[model samples]
Structure formats: C-alpha cells, structure tokens
Target chain A: MGPLFPQEIIGEELNILIGFFIGIGFGFLLEAAGFTNTRKLAGVFYGYDFVVLKVFFSAAITSAIGLFIMNQYGIIDMSAIFYPKTFWIPTLVGGLIMAFGFIIGGFCPGTSMCAAVTGKIDAMVFIGGALIGVFFYAYTYEPLWKELRDSGAMGKVNIAEWMGIDSGLFILILTLIAASAFYAVTIIQKKVTAKGDYQI
Target chain B: MERSKKYMNPYLAGILIGVFMIAAYYFSGEGLGASGALKSVVVATTDMVAHDYATEHSYFSARVSDPENPPIKTWLVFEVLGVLVGAIISAAFAGRLKLETIKGPNVTTKTRFITAAIGGLLFGIGSQLGRGCTSGMVMSGMGVLSLSGFIGLMAIFGGGYVLAYFFRKLWI
Candidate 1:
C-alpha cells in the first residue's frame, strides 16, 4: 500500500522528484539547527553544547517509535524497507575512522554539504579532501582495502531480534534512554559552558 | 545588512528531520543517504572517462554492467541535490549565507581547512569500506532495528570521543 516507488504507485521521475524535495528538507534542518557551526558540532565531545547529541538522539528515537507504530498498524511494510547488513569488523574499524574525521573536521558528509552550501569555506576544503579520499580508495582497491572491505560477512540482522526482545519494547526502552540523555546533557551543557564565553 | 541569524530549536528541527526520514522510507522503500550519492557520482564519472577500465574494475563493474540502471539515475543523487537547494533556502531565510571559514579562534583558517580536508578524506575512505556513513548505515539502520546501525553508532560516536581530545586545538 505504501513505498510508492517500489510499488509503482509513482513513476521513476516523480519518485526521484520526491527524493529531491525530502533531501532539501533534511538539508534545511541540518543548517537551521546550527550544524553549520563547527564549534557547535564539536561541542558534543567537549561537554559544552549538547545540541548535536540532543538532536541526534531525539531524531533517532522519534523515527524508531514512529516506524514501530506504523508497522504495528500495517501502514507500511517494515519487512520491505532496505536494512543495512551487518559486517561487524569493517563497520567498527570504519566508524572509528569516521569518528576521527568528525572531530578534526567538525562535520560529517551530510553536515559538511549543508555548511558548504551555506557558505562555509572550511566545508569546501573538506569536500575536496573527500573527493581525494574517494579517488585514493578507488585506485588502491585491489591491494589495500578489497579484502578488509568484504570481511566478516554476517548478512542482514536485526538488533532487537538478536537481543531477544520485541521490537516495540526495544523502541520504548530506547526512547526512555534518549529522554534521560536529553535531561543529563542539559545539565552538563550548563555546567561546562557556564562561564566559558565560547560565543558562536 | 542584518547580522547572522539564530538557528532553529534542536528538538523542533529534529522532529522535522525525523518526519522526513520516515516519509522517505514509506515512499522509496529506502532510507536517507548522502555518501552513497557521492559514490554514485564518482562511479558514473569514472565510468564515463574510462569505459573499458571501469567495466573491468571490480568496484565499478557492478554499477556499469547494468546499463539500464546507471548509478547517476539513483534516488539518493536526486535527494542530495534537493538537500543542497533546501540548505541554500534555509540559509538565505536566516541571513546566514556568508563567505567565511567556520573555525575556532585558537586555530588559523589554513590549519582548520587542512584538517577538515584530511578528515573528509578519511571519512570518504571509511564510508566506502564500512558500506555507509552516519546517515545511511547508522541512523537509517537504527530506524529498523538493524544491528549494523547500532555497531556504526557505537563506532562513530565512540571513536569521536576517543579522538576528540587529540584534535582539541582544531576545535576549541
């Protein structure tokens, strides 16, 4: 009944058009939330501003809950949605690499695009760096990363099922944790930035 | 001219983003992704430049073999283009569109720009290896309770915390 493109409820052109609109909304929100500010983005790790944490956790929980409720009501086919397959070793190592990138750069791929479009010169440099990295990987694919890339093939697995819990219950618990995190971080932000004068 | 404007409330912005993410799933049967779009762009461009080599290489082969399903004709690519448009609009409305480098007072613009480039390069390589970035693998995966998403979340956030201190000069 849903997933218009997959179901042919919408044509290819319209489907992509919708994607374009949605992407714009996503990008707009990222910039509007101060994600364009490198200092604000990096503050998550420094215990200063918690906007990144708050927004990320809240958005995650909100989507989780919304999807669960929709699935329970059969509004969307939860089973058909594209879920990423787990490759534990690569993801762990890759994530670590990305983490370093985040702290040093103060933006991820998505946020960097946001900042770049909004006139952040630093983000422009970051994009150049990303292009170079992509080219490097492409050139050295056979020798450097091909093997490690395909290692630890676990296929697609759901965490809720792996943890032996109902999906709904897991969503609820995650929501609670996020709410608690928001509360804790608000206090931490106050304490950390109280007199620092790290004005944006 | 007006001073740079204030940002939106994080919670409210998060909700709007969350709704869009959900809508994306329902419409396309897919999650939000940014890096994949870039990868597609890279693949398409490379294929065009070196058709024989592109078809021969393992990385570009899968995308190139399917003549009907070119990488450039993908949903994420269009979505990303929209992201640029949307971001520009929002920046314009807020009077935040200015040509400047976002950095800390402690760091020179040159230093900040260099580090940002290096960071972006690493992220680009890592995303290819990991099969996704924060939005694709972590956030979208988590929406459906995928274990990989949790792993990505842990690795990226954990990794950031571990490295943040060493990179403090670049930021604070």
Candidate 2:
C-alpha cells in the first residue's frame, strides 16, 4: 500500500524530489547534532564524548520501532524495499577497513560531505581521497577484489528471523539495550571529562 | 553571530532523523545513502572518459550499461546534492562556517591531512567492496533488522575498538 514509488503511486520525478527532501532532513539533523565536527565524531572512540553512540543507537532503535509498527499497520510494505543482501565475508572485512577510516579520517562518508560543505579543509581532502580510492577499486576489481566481493552471499536475510525472534520483539530488545547503553555512556562521559586531560 | 551556539540535543536529533528515515522508506522504498552517490559519479566519469573501456570492464560495465538513463541520473546523487545544500544552510545558521583544519593538538596539520586522505581512500574502497557504508548498510539495515546491517554494525564498531589503539594519537 505504501512505498509510493515502488507501488507506482508516485512518479519517478516525484520520487527523486522525495529523496532530495529526505537528504535535506538527514543533512540538517547530522549538522544540528554536531556531527559535522570531526572532534565530536572521533570523540566516541576516545570516551570523552558519547554523542555519536547515543545519537546513532537512539536513531537506529527509533527507526527500527517505527518500521516495525508501520509494517504491522500496513502503512508500508517492508518486503518491497531495497534490502541489502547478507554477504558476511566482504561486509566484515570492508567494515573493518571503514572503521580504520573513521578513526583516521575522523569522519564517515556522510559526515565528510556535510563537513566539506561547511568548509572543513580536511574533509575536502578526505573526499578527494575517497574519489581516488573508488577509482582504484574500479580499476583493480578484476585482479584484486572481484572474488572477495562476491563471496559469502546470503541473500537478504533478516537478523530477527535468524535469531528466531519476532521482528517486534527484536525491536523491543534493541530499545532496552540502547537505553541502558545511554545511561552507561553518560556516566562514562562524566568520568572522562573529570580527568581534565582530554578536551573535545 | 553566536559563535558559541550549542548543538541540538542528540536524542532529539536522533528522533528527527528516525522520522526522516521512515519518510524515506514510505516514499522511495529505500534508505538514505552517501557512498553510492559517489560511486555513481565514478561510473559516470569512467563512461565519459572511455566509453568502450567502461562498457567492457566488468566492474564499470555492470553499472554503466543502463540504456534507459545515464549513471549520474540517480536518486542518491540528487539526495547528496540536497545534503550539501542542507549542511551549508545549517552551518550558516549556527555560525560554524569557517575555513580551517580540525585535528588533535598533538598532531601536525600536515599529518592530519595526510591521514585523513588515506582514511578516506580506504573507506572508499571498503564501501565498494562491502556494498554500503555506515548509513546505507549499517543504519538502514538495522532499521529493518537486516543481518548484513547488524554484521556491519559489529564489524565497524568492533573493528574500531580493535584498531583504536593504533590510531589513538590521531584523535586522542
């Protein structure tokens, strides 16, 4: 009933417009949450600031719950969405590499774009690096990464299904976990800030 | 301008983003993405530079051979353009628009620039291999309880914790 574009309720032109508006909302929230600041993003790893964790977990849980409810009420059809297939091997290896990128670059792709627009010279350089990296991967795909990228193809698996739990129940459990982590991180942030040596 | 303006509460910001994600799914049947937009740009560039080669290479051909439209006429590309606009608007309102480099006090500006570039390079390649970055693969996947998303979440965060010690000087 929902997913207006896929359902043909919305035209291609309108779908692109919706994407633009959504991107605006996303960019605004990221900037408002101080995600454009490199130090704030990197702060999660250092324990001086847990904004990244708090924001990230809260957002994930919120969306998980929202989606679960929407699906139940028939507001949106989850099956029609573009779900990512589960390719464990490449995802794990690539995620590890991205983690290093996050630590060293102090920004992810989304945040880098936001920061670059906000006049962060370092972010601009990081973007240039990303372009170069994408080109390098494309060029070397056959010899270097083709096999690894295609390995471990588990198609569009759901985590809750894998865990043998109802989707709603999984959302409930995730919400609980996120709440506890939020409380824990506040204490950690207070303790870390009290040390006075580390400044964000 | 208030140079010291405080950021919006993170929890509030998170909720706002959550609502946006729902809107994204309801309308477009897909989640938000950043890296894919860049990938489109790469595909388009290659197609432009070497039409024959791009159509011949397995990697580039898979993306570039769409006869209906060019690779750059994609939703992510437009969304990313909107991202730039929204970010600039917010930065301007917050009085945070300044041309400068950010880094730890201990690190040299040159070192920060070099490391940041290298980090971006790795992320670029990794996102391609992994098929998505944090926003697309991890966060969007988590929303729908996708296994790939959970694994990505763990790997990225776990990997960060594992390698945080090595890059401690860069941020800490």
Candidate 3:
C-alpha cells in the first residue's frame, strides 16, 4: 500500500512529481522555521538562538517516531525505500569538514539552497563554490579521493540493532534526550540574549 | 528595510516537516534529501561541456549512462526545483523576499563572502565523499535509526561546537 514507487504502484514520473510537492513543504517549513537566516542557524552553536536545534531535533524525532510506528503497523515497507549506508571513517571526516562549512558558510546544503533561491547574495556565491568543489572532486577522484571515500564500509547497519536495543526504545531515548536539550537550550538562549541583544 | 511576518514556531514547523518527510517515504519511497541536486547539476553541466571526460570519469559515468534516470531527471533534482519554488513562495508571503547579502557587523563583505565560498567548497567535497549532505545523510538517516546518520549528526554538530570558539568573530 505504501512506497508506491518501488511497489510499482506509481510510475517514475509520478514518484518524481510527488517528490516535488513534498519538497515544497520541506522548503516552506524550512523558511518558516527561520532557516533562511544564517544568524538563526549560527545561533545554535553560539547559544544565542536555538531554533535550528529545536526544529532539527523535533523534525528528526517526529519523523523517527512516526515512521517507526507506521512500520510497526505495516503501513509502510521500510525495506522498499532508499536507506543510506554507513561509512564510518569517511562520514566522520566528511562530517567534520561539513561542520566547518556550517559554521563558516552559515548554511548546510539544503538550507543554502533555499536561502539562495530566496535571494541571499552570499548564498548564491556559496552555490558557486559548491559547484566548483564538486567539479574538483569529480576530476580528481581517481588520484586523490577515491580510496578514502570508499573506506570503512559497514553495510546498512541500524543503530538500534547494533546497540542490541529495540527500535522503539531507542527512539524513545532519543526523544527524551532531544527534549531535555530543548529545555536546556531555551535557558541558555535566554541567558545569552539577556546578556546582550545582538542583531543578525 | 521592510518588516516581515514572524516565523512559525519551531516546534510546529518541525511537526510539519516531519509530516512531509513521512509523506515522502510513503509516496516517493525516500526521505528528506537536498544535496543530490547539486551533484546532478554538476554532472549534467560537465556532461555538456566535456562529454568525453564526463563519460569516462568513474564518478560521473554511471549517472551519465543511466538513461532511465539521467542526471537532470533524478528525483532529488525535481525535489530541489520544488524547494526553490516553495522557498520563493514562503519568502514572498513573509515579505522577506529581497536580494541582499547577510553578514556579521564586524566583518567586511569581502571577508564574509570569501569565508562562505571556502565553506561551501569544503562542504561540496565532503558531501560527495560522505555520500550525502546534512538532510540526505544525517537528518533522514538518523530518523530511520541508521548508524551512519547518527555518526554524522554527532560529527557535524560536535565539530561545530568545538570550532565555534575559534570562528566566533565570524558569527558573533
């Protein structure tokens, strides 16, 4: 009944069409959550604004909970969908590099796309830089990056299974952690803003 | 500057985003992803400019050869197209739709732009190396309890906190 694309319940065009609509919602929510603002995103690290953290955790946990329950009830086939593979070494190194991008660029790939579309000049420039980066990678793959990117291949491991815990229980624990962090961040944001209100 | 409407509460926005994500899984059989388009654009553009090189390259060959899902016709490309439209609509509705450069007060426009370019360049390479960006890898991956996603989540955020002090002037 679900995963219409893989099940042949829908054609590729329809799948792509539906994806487009869903992306609209994603973009709308992103902008509505103040994600277009670099300052808002940067605030999470600086303790000045936690909208990024709050929205991010809430979205992730909510999707986790919702999808997990849906899977339990047999509404959607998790296996029929595209799931990302785990590459610990490269992921760690790449993620660290992206962290510098986040702090310096003030936007991740998604947020930057949305921001650039909505007319942020710096975002447009950032897109240019990303294009160049991708080109550089594509050209130099054989010599410079191929090996490192392909390292540490652990195939499709779920964290819950790896930890020897129930998926539901793991999600519950994650939710609690996110909730507590939300509470703590709210307080930190208050203290930081109270100290001095800076403009973004 | 013109005043814009206040943003929606973060919690509610998060809920809406979750609903959309679930819908994506239900219909398209994918979760939130936004960086694939960047790669696609690169592949397509490269294919056009240097067809021989693109076709021969290991990185771009598979994408270029796949007729059923050509580089430009990928799901993420359409999705990102919609993101652009949706973002434009939302920004317009919020009265925040305008062309401007955002930067910290302490830094000049030159420094800010240069920093942003370098950051974007690094992120582009990292995303390709890691197989996805924040949304495609970490956010959606973690939602499904994938170890890769969780690892990325910790790395990016943890790394950010560690480096924030050094780059404080950039933002603060």
Off by over 4 Å in 2: none
Instruction: Compose the digit string of candidate 2's lDDT tens values, residues A32-70.
Output: 898888888888887888888878887788888888888
Q: Output DockQ, candidate 3.
A: 0.81
Listed per model in order, the count of residue pairs whose N, CA or C atoms clash below 3 Å is 0, 0, 0
Worst 10 residues of 1 chain B by lDDT: B1-10
Which parts of model 1 have CA positions greater than 4 angstroms off? Answer: none
lDDT of 3 by residue, B40-142 (tens): 9999999889988888989989888877767998788888888888888899999888898888767888988998899899889888888899899998998
Instruction: Give TM-score values for chain A, per-prediction.
Output: 0.96, 0.97, 0.97
Q: Which residue pairs clash within candidate 1?
A: none
Q: Of the candidates numbered 1 and 3, which has the greater lDDT value?
A: 3
- Model 2 C-alpha RMSD vs. true structure (Å) is 1.2
Regarding DockQ, does 1 or 3 come out ahead? 3
